[model samples]
Target: MTAPHHDLRQLQRQAGELDVRLAAARHTATSADQLVTAVVTGQGKLVDLRIDDRALYGANAQKLGLGIVEAVRNARNAARASSLPELNALFGLQPPPPVAGTAPPLPPAPLSPPPQARESVQRQAEPDDESFEEFDFLTDEEPESGGGRW
Candidate 1:
């Protein structure tokens, strides 16, 4: 006899919905004085930049760029805390994934900054990683759709 009907298509639909929602998320970060801010999409893409009037008075490219990045990243962290309850439940702050049959992902070294932002604050002065504890995604394997989706 044929197997009972059990199409996996429903699982695929759920996976699509999860990815769509993730792609639409946005995070924010701020300067200590709230003078500068940047919004970064969930995918770590810079989305918007906001600067207070005071920030513009004597803004240097280096400082301004740094503030924007920091602010956006800060916001992103906060968003993660508020949003991915399910991911946290599953991963519990585990690091990135690993090869199919290998150990988990190793802690990666910092890479070069984007060419456009040559004068990046992070590039100029290597800040202590402890200072920015926002990037929750990197700290853990953010969950996507269950494998059954595929």
Candidate 2:
């Protein structure tokens, strides 16, 4: 019916608008000490980075690196937080309720294979003793015959 067609058209239009918004979205964040600043897109791709000259003074690579990482992480978190509402709307999901006095949950640690499985894999990957036959080509004996002339 006409209603279904209208709904599809509306959805297409909303998608186009969301695409434009996402493309134009940019979030900026600075490190706690204000030594590093980072700008990221809606998808958390770093677009710009700025570091204070003081941050590099005395060649403190570790401090500078940490500042850069913090700024970039903050920028990415900002981008995600800003875009989450629209994403939830598009997906028809309710925003999770905030818990007081609780920090955001950390991502789960990566799973590793059990020791038995790892040992099995290692055993399977090992080459057998009989798999290769040694060939000795350094014998002092000369050829028995020269069948063809040069």
Candidate 3:
């Protein structure tokens, strides 16, 4: 009767339907060469693997292994890609409501410093003699440079 109770019941029904769909979800893929085939569930469990007899006939073992992996990956990717659109539709989701009106008033214009404060900041930024000193490492008092070697 109330809005919250109705929403909860609708959500529970949708969840039950989604659970049923997920339990039924499956994807199958075969390698490009049709040598390997794989079937996976929405939960990404490998339900079946099939290898053609011709695939095993003098096929490189490593290549066959790679083909099987590729098939499984393709199946999982297909399952994910197909399920996403269905779930989105079931939930009635859309692209974020297009930013209502005048772009949220532009964050209150960033509070600039007054001219006097800016001048003070500029004066402080200028280097003073007390902040730095030049040092000469080659001043004529070093023993090795004065031609005295131990």
Candidate 4:
């Protein structure tokens, strides 16, 4: 019983130390084209952002937005990588191998479906000639007398 209590106390102490370390941690990353940079905390909260004047010279909103997102994502990954060892130790897991870079390359964006597939979807969505009939708006019938006109 005492042994278990001692172990619990030790774990609590280690967790406290980890919390302090995380609070003091900062990680930085830059966009591939050197256009943007971001700094984040160990908890992956953005602390700073920097953009090169060149990036804004002729850039559209979408291009600048993507650069900012990339930098922040990389910075967060770096912070997570840096904290992995301490986190593993706290949980009694084996130390992870050294990280070579901020993080693995992000997976490629999904590609749009082929033109043939798109055409097929459009064909399916079209109304069949038998399914809908045209309505004539030129009918000569008079309006019903129930409601008065404005």
Best by lDDT: 4
Off by over 4 Å in 3: 95-150
TM per candidate: 0.44, 0.54, 0.52, 0.61
Local distance difference test values of all predictions, in order:
0.52, 0.67, 0.63, 0.69
What's model 4's TM-score? 0.61
- Model 2: per-residue lDDT, tens digit, 46-68? 99999888886654444676688
Ordering by lDDT: 4, 2, 3, 1
In model 1, pairs of residues that clash are 28-75, 29-71, 29-75, 30-71
All candidates: CA RMSD in angstroms? Answer: 19.1, 15.3, 21.6, 12.8
* Residue 86 of model 1, lDDT score: 32
Q: Which stretches of candidate 1 lie over 4 Å from their true place?
A: 1-11, 59-62, 88-150
Clashes (backbone N, CA, C under 3 Å), per candidate, total 4, 0, 0, 0
Best by TM-score: 4
Give the 10-residue window scoring lowest on summed lDDT in candidate 3: 100-109
- Where is model 4 more than 4 Å wrong at Cα? 95-150
lDDT of 4: 0.69
10 residues in a row with least lDDT, candidate 2: 129-138
Residue range 1-150, candidate 1, lDDT tens digits: 233224345545655665565567776667656878777654556778888877655434335555665676566665554445534323445543332112222222223466667656556655533323222233243334322211
What is candidate 3's TM-score against the reference?
0.52
The candidate with the higher TM-score, 1 or 4, is: 4
**lDDT tens digits by residue: candidate 4, 21-139:** 77778888887777889998877889999998887654333367778887888888777777776788678897544652334534323234688987787678756322211221233
